[model samples]
Target: MPETIFRNWTSDLSRDWGKKPIQIDHSLSQNELFSKDALAELIERYPIEHYSLMRTSSRGEEKKIWRRGEVGGLSGHEVMAQIASGGLWLQLRELKLVDKRYHDLLQSIYGEVEQRVPGFDSFNHEMGVLISSPNAKAHYHADLPGQALWQIMGRKRVYIYPAEEPYLPQEELEKIALTGLESALRYDPEFDRHALVLDLEPGQMLTWELNAPHRVENHDELSVSMTTEHWTEEIRREQMLTVANGILRKHFGVSPKRRSTEGAGFWAKAVLQAGWRRSPWYKREQRKMMPVDFRLAPGTSTTIVDIPAYVV
Candidate 1:
């Protein structure tokens, strides 16, 4: 990694680490991972359980899951080719946990981050690479941690909304974090009036207020980007709080009045989480899978096949 990366970092580094959305232009190398061929190989060789390829409309409203095997005999390159020539966003998720290069990259990025912002060290960091077809949209969503999107190739527009209710109610946040589902929230186009939209190009990246509701839309060309998620000590404690509060709301049918992670209420909720999550019922609930109904057809941009079209 050359120091040429992150050339756009601001002098006001202390104020911009995660409290607001900031676009650092010229912040990444497009080839930090490897060449296009290498990316195809990585996409192919990546574990089936770890990757997610999905087909969707331009606004990302209608969605159907796509699997590598659906793309002829060669799942890796075929999936890559499909994404390059067709319409999809293939998320090779949790790369830091699966591949060493990615793990090192996360550590390296944070090393830089720690230097820029004093007293800012993140834990349980998760990283992912996203490849998307032209005009693909990532519907409005939020995550449970401090988040950032680094663009490596092509262009996209990101809409960051206010981190408030109606946009993101507290109960929904607790439910999303507790259920282990992708944090997709209800999207109302009306909210666009209140959004701060940014156009991202290669060599630029965006980080926003933690847990802020946002979404993405790619331009007419294919796009590749890296996404980082991490929890601070305070953020992790908030996770525990979300979980504990969720249990209080769902199981006990009691509405929690306290949202802070510091009181006797927090202690009670934490204990409840410790006991409730230990049950087999909770384990079973976590294992439930959403249906994968379709996959992108081989060698095409818009074609898709029914789930019965493939054997595995």
Candidate 2:
């Protein structure tokens, strides 16, 4: 049987999630585990759906827009196309819970990976489970905190772009982040080179630095995976302050405490901004960030890995 689900089960995900560069071959065997039948079951069991039209405040006009359909909705692909065309803020959550067969697979995989490196908690409430489809495109946006995507089952092709140089601006990022994980896109047209292209199969995992631009395409017939997000208090505090600032800017049309934002707010956005800009925090943090690589054998052995903390 699978381990009992804890409301705080995600506590395990944050520990040691980003302490060192990741290496997975030591923890699990190098092989794929899920069978074709298992993959088919996942495809048929989940209810797919698409999106209707949505309206967003663009400049001064009420613009008509649409997004990639929610997980259980229809025309998920069309929703994505619409989103790519006009851009929208999105937050895709899992509708159908995972099954025992899949949950058991994760338990075994986690066991082997966690034995090596431990996990660290960022003390945030955000935790997520794998959906039936892996085709969810996050667009070309960067995150405030780091993210680790584990391929519990099926295969996916991931394209990653580096941070720094031709960076995405603040206003665009704030727009999406303020939208509350809803349909939004903040892509940079000038970014050069695809940093990494990965063909992730079962038991394999990947992690990239916070705000690192990346997109995924589900290659196989169906895909299932877990993406546990983490962001440090530092990152969260900055985002919270950004939201607060955005609220003031939009709702009341007033800027608050900017007289000298150095010592203001919980985490103090001004301090973080200065540190993030001048200091080596970005590079140091990037160096501390690592990719989690995992592979499992066809039989019964288990695998495990830390689900590091993120700012978001």
User: Which lDDT tens digits does candidate 1 get at residues 23-139?
Assistant: 876445555474566677787677756776676555444666434423334556666656766566788888987789879878988877888888897888888889888888887
TM-score of each: 0.86, 0.47
- Candidate 1 deviant stretches above 4 angstroms: 32-34, 58-72, 75-78, 290-312
Tens digit of per-residue lDDT, candidate 2, span 1-312: 533222122333345345321313211112232343443344334433211122222223356522222222223343333333332322223322345554444444444335433543353323233433324333455666656676655577777776544554445455545554422445554453545677877666676655556767665234555555556655565566665554455456765444222353644554544454454533432322112221111222111122332321
Error of 1 at 181 (Å): 2.6
Best-performing candidate as measured by TM-score: 1
lDDT of 2 at 97: 38
Model 1 residue 54 CA deviation in Å: 1.6
- Model 1 has an lDDT value of 0.76
- Against the unseen true structure, what C-alpha lDDT does each candidate score? 0.76, 0.43
